[model samples]
Target: MHRSAETSLEDQAVDIRIQMIQLGWDTLTSVPKSRAGERSVTLDEATTRVLQEWRTRQNKERLAAGPDWNESGLVFTHPDGTGLRPSWVSEEFARIAARAGLPPIRLHDLRHGAASLSLAAGVDVKVVSAELGHSTTAFTQDTYQSVFPRVAREAAEATAGLLSGDAARQA
Candidate 1:
């Protein structure tokens, strides 16, 4: 989600924009692969509030930094306001996980977990794919189908019910 849109949503709508990222030496660039990667996602209320609070905190830090701030305007940034290095982010995640006594997991794995959660919550596959910046819905389905077996089974059963003229009424 871009910072401006996130802070401006008075009705609690959230938009995710996968427009830029730190890929190798290039710190930021347009969507990585295709147009599908650039999209807006609606966030649940809890996530929206968390982001709003995070922005507020960031603003406080910006004020404290004053002239020292780099003003990169990224949601995640270094203490001096520059973009955070990807490796540093991963290492910090590992350190925090260890401190919390949690099992080890790569930072990237969180993206997969988010996809699974969205699918399990009955969000449409295409929407999840877009939010994940997937090149195609097929890839999203193929990758995540195994993680959301129950939802997939329910989908199959719903299709069967449709054939039996029952799903329409349920819908």
Candidate 2:
């Protein structure tokens, strides 16, 4: 089960408890699209520190808003603590990416990049699949994981070394 954002932040993790979707004129909070989507993602040290700073800033915003604060209990929110629209967030991301001179990419492409990087870094496919909330490793591999040229070359070299008994000698 997912804990409150406050509690999860203390643990340096973000629990995927709910999803917020904008439907035409209304915004709705609902369960995730799949069972696997309701999982926890642990943060690295830098990310945890950044979130801690953001939380402190958010608290100040809440105090400034006083009675006007919405208390949505979400990690990301507007100055008055209301949820941001998903479409707006995507548009903002695109603008930010463009300002950085990055090639055009949808915000969702970050997930694919993360998955590919994890696989290239030698993380187990099952673990990467779980992190991505993928139903199966095969789907994760087929859709997100790419054989980075460096990683493929390393695998080829390792296989050749093993066949020539050079791997044992190196070990």
Highest lDDT against the true fold, candidate: 2
lDDT of 2 by residue, 1-171 (tens): 222453466787787878778798687788989999888787788988987897899899999999999987877888998888888888999999999999999998998998899899989999998888888999999998788899999999878888786667767
* Regions of candidate 2 where Cα sits further than 4 Å from its true position: 1-7, 165-171
What lDDT does candidate 2 reach at residue 29? 80
Clash count (model 1, backbone only): 1
TM-score of each: 0.71, 0.90
Span of 10 residues, lowest total lDDT, candidate 2: 1-10
Tell me how many clashing residue pairs each candidate has: 1, 0
Any residue pairs clashing in model 1, and if so which? 16-41
Residue 95 lDDT, candidate 1, scale 0-100: 98
List RMSD in Å for every model shown: 4.8, 2.7
Worst 10 residues of 1 by lDDT: 1-10
Score candidate 1 by lDDT.
Answer: 0.72
